[model samples]
Target: MDNDEPLEPETQDEPETEPAPQNSDETLYCEAEASVAVDKDKAARESSETDLEIEDTEKFFTTGQRELYLEACKLMGVVPVSYFLRNMEESYMNLNHHGLGPNGTKAIAIALVNVSNNDLGLEGARIISEFLQRNISSLWNLQLSGNNFRDESAELLCQALSSNYQIKTLDLSHNQFSDKGGEYVGQMLALNIGLQSLDLSWNHFHVPGAVALCNGLRVNTTLQKLDLSMNGFGNEGATALGEVLRLNNSLVYLDISCNDITNDGVSKISKGLEVNESLKVLKLFLNPMSMDGAVSLILSIKRNPKSKMEEIDISNVLVSEQFLKILDGVCAIHPQLDVMYKSVQGFSAKKALLQWTNPMKLIQGYADQHKITVLDFFKSLNPKGVMTMPVGDFRKAMIQQDKVPVNLHQVRELIRKLDDKTGMVNFSLLKTVKP
Candidate 1:
């Protein structure tokens, strides 16, 4: 042993170890490191993609069209993540709400011809008219809502409607179109047989406009649904539309809610409905059609067995106890027809009941599993075959074993609604249940 270093183990002579090949042809020393570098580069690219998401958010939402859309476009900043990832419809909606110039509107209109979103909202006035003039034949639906459309744009629309046949749905709501615009719309309605749905809501088109539109409807048969809500259609307008309804055989759904129409107006509609057979759904909310007008409509419905109306919306109307009594009488006659009595608040009772826990689904599953009706399932729980059970036991059995989470109070009310003769739920009355 030497003093300077520890003694090393003396071994037999061996050949220098060779670098092993990682693959059949690849060497560990150089080529393997190269493959690792390539993998690292690919990983770097993915990391940069994530970094791009972070960096893009810093300057997102460029308020490009703020001035044009007024305050409505204030929030129309380009959110970096959604902007790049959003589909055509999202892009169109974002483009629609914000302010856009003529060139921009034209671009969007041209783009819409190829996309599923046939609706374009060009707040740009003349640009929208020009787009309609050019692409009206290509579009199936055009929504020019909230545009400052006066007679000039109306003339353009009328010209488009005269020759165009492809466009079916047009929404010109939330504009300042007076009688002049309405007259042009009437001309369009008279000429365009392809138009099915028209929404002229929330505008200044009053009784004259309504009359002009009705004049067009006299000859038009293809129109199915019409929304003239919030256009201040007084008694005169309502009367005109009522007369048209009598003749317009193809029209199915009519929404004249919040149009300030009165009993005299609805009286005309009632008379028209007596002769009408195609109209199925009628919306008459937010109007002060005191009990008399509603009664008139109800009486007309009762008289006409051929009346196809399955639903009537009388929510928010000024009704007395007499009105409800009359409605109950009407319902007693036609339990299949749905009469919406109360206004839907911030939420819908039916919608919530369906969404939250799906107790109806649970009951349906139980009924299917047992191969019996829900009524039969309840009968199984009772020892004696009585027509009814205590509400407490019924609720407990459902909640504890079957796990149905329907509202107890609503259940009680539903029992009463189903069986007017008994305070408890009688399953035989299930035949009266309507969807």
Candidate 2:
């Protein structure tokens, strides 16, 4: 009994002590500390990766070259960008979406490299012009599209280009350069002898500027391809281009689409093609020309058996039976000649009735198709027995498919031809000979 009592007393006296329960806040603090340590390690690794990338980029240029670029930046009072310097050593430099303002642009231009989509304003252009005047041989292709270069900036660039002969391809598209800029470009083109391809598309060049540019092209002996699309070069501008084609022997490919050129402008171009033996490709699409103008173009090709015209793009101009016939004839002679055209002209119909060569044929075709006499159709349109109708009414009637269908331009031409001094179409003229 005594041994059992001693053992029980000893066990009661020595109650085991368990570890204190860990606090919730202490556990959270430990986890946060570990997370912070991991983040610090990751940041160190990222910093090392960035340093390695910089080292790799530095391998692209020699120490001397790097120093030169840095010195240029220092002299120009600009800070050098790491990516720009790295890209400058490559064959093609892509600086798109880089908000390189005027100062940044000047720094890049001093390096004489190709870049795009920079907001290089007038000051930037002036800086580049200074480099261009230096006649740097390293820079061959200059692409300044979508840079917001206005007339003044373009003028500065053109002046610089006048003395430089090393550049071969120059793209000044999608800029705000107007006629003043165009005049400057023309002057530069006249002097520069080494440039081969030029793109001045999507600019604000008008008749005067376009004519001036063409005048320069006429004297230029080196340029091979030119793009003047999406400008305001109207009939007079086309006339000047025609003159360039007539004289210039170097230009092989030309694009003058969407230049507000009409039938008269096309006629002028046709006249130039009659004697031009060097031009191979001509793009005149999106101009408000008709089948008559197309026919004239084909005939011009026919007249000049020596003409080297291989491709003619008039895809915006509609096709007609007479035009196809003439095209077939011309193609028989020039088997290599390619003519690009789209749908036939009409109001939702496949074949158009209106043709500038002969409006009477259109009237006769509709008259025969609807089984009505010309005089009767005119009377239906007039219906007043006054033998005359307003020009607008005649135009509306001519535009209807059930009636004498013609396009708006054809109606205007018809009105001009048939309307007496009273601004009214004489329906009675249907009975007389063709006016």
Candidate 3:
């Protein structure tokens, strides 16, 4: 019974007491102050030389190691739910490893949840779409060419573009999109606000698809460079595109080569150029615009007061001397039209002759004054310097081998003499000589 009364007097000293005259709030304030002081002291001690003597530590994973780690996490069902959520701050740093490295397959799935809400079965597509959407403002040079994307994939891409307002350069070249995909992309362009350059070359956009794009360009004002080359747009497509150019003031460079465009197509484009003052570089090469079309274009250039065209490529067009004369006249007058002519080696020999004929004649006459004949001039013109004469009528002159100019009668006499001697006239030698 006595153990309950004197138990405390026999043992340890009592703890120290504080004066508590403060109100409830003040007491709480004091307790907070005491707690803060204790924490400060503990922090100071923990940061002392003893703790400093311990080595600082960090963890780094190589690309391959990170891939294995993420793969293991995925297989263990720990990545998509917990690992990614816990490492959001490091996600971007890890992206180079996961998105562009071996572990990219696993990291892309987790990253998609943050950017895209699409349930695309492929892991990278949804993730990349989302990343582009989120970083659209910073992705000025986005190159997604040769991605093997389908029409449905283009639809999803258009959906992303409809919401994004900051991508400036988009290279969608070498894709498998047809007119339907082009229509979808055209619709996106009609609504997109920040795109400046679009490369749709090598796509399969026919006249109908071009019409859709024309409709889009009629409204879009931010696009500056558009590459529609290699699309096989014929006269009808050119006409449709010309309609848009008449109204569009933002576009500066237009490439419409290899489109099978004829004079009618060039006419449509000229009509658009009549009003367009912003176009600088126009590529009309590899089209079927004949000499007449080129002459028409030269006339248009002469007439257009707003024609500030800096570069014009009329290569592969059937340009005759008349067309070149017109172009030279325009160049003499304007002096600003920088024309590019890609001469076909053989097909353009006539035009080349017309161009250098006067100079060639002057040089040849100077050489002839030194005893050079027209045959000698032809020999000099040929790469091997071997004179090959004309056939038929010229062959007759060859039979008369004497240097003296022979008349038709003497040519016949020589042919008969050769026939009598050899039983046959040497027509092969006749074939190589000029009249």
Root-mean-square deviation of candidate 2: 23.3
The sequence of per-residue lDDT tens digits that candidate 2 reaches over residues 296-372 is 88899999988877668888777876677777678667654667777665444423433344667777787799888
Instruction: For candidate 1, write residues 211-325 as lDDT tens digits.
Output: 8978988788888888888878889988988888788889888999998988999999898888888887789988778767877988887877767665577777555556656
Number of the top lDDT candidate: 2
Q: What is the per-residue lDDT of model 3 for residues 1-435, given as tens digits with 9 covering 90 to 100?
A: 222232111111212331222221111111112346766574343323221111121133223223433333333222221223334335462221111222323344433322122233333444445545654234455555666665666777777787787778887776667778778888998998889988888778888788777888888889988988888678998998788778888887889888889999998888887777777668888887876676666677677777666557787765554565677677554444555665432455554445433333443456567786644543443344443422222323332234443332233343343342422343334334433
RMSD of each: 19.6, 23.3, 25.4
- Please give the range of 10 consecutive residues that has the lowest summed lDDT in model 2: 6-15
Task: Tell me the whole-model lDDT of each prediction, alpha carbons only.
Answer: 0.59, 0.71, 0.56
Model 2 segments more than 4 A misplaced: 1-78, 81-87, 91-112, 345-435
Order of the predicted models by TM-score, top scorer first: 2, 1, 3
**For candidate 2, what is the TM-score?**
0.61
Candidate 1 RMSD to the real structure: 19.6
Instruction: Tell me the deviation in Å of residue 261 in model 1.
Output: 1.1
Of the two candidates 2 and 3, the one with more favorable lDDT, higher being better, is: 2
**Backbone clash pairs in model 2 (N, Cα, C under 3 Å; residues 3+ apart or in different chains), count:** 0
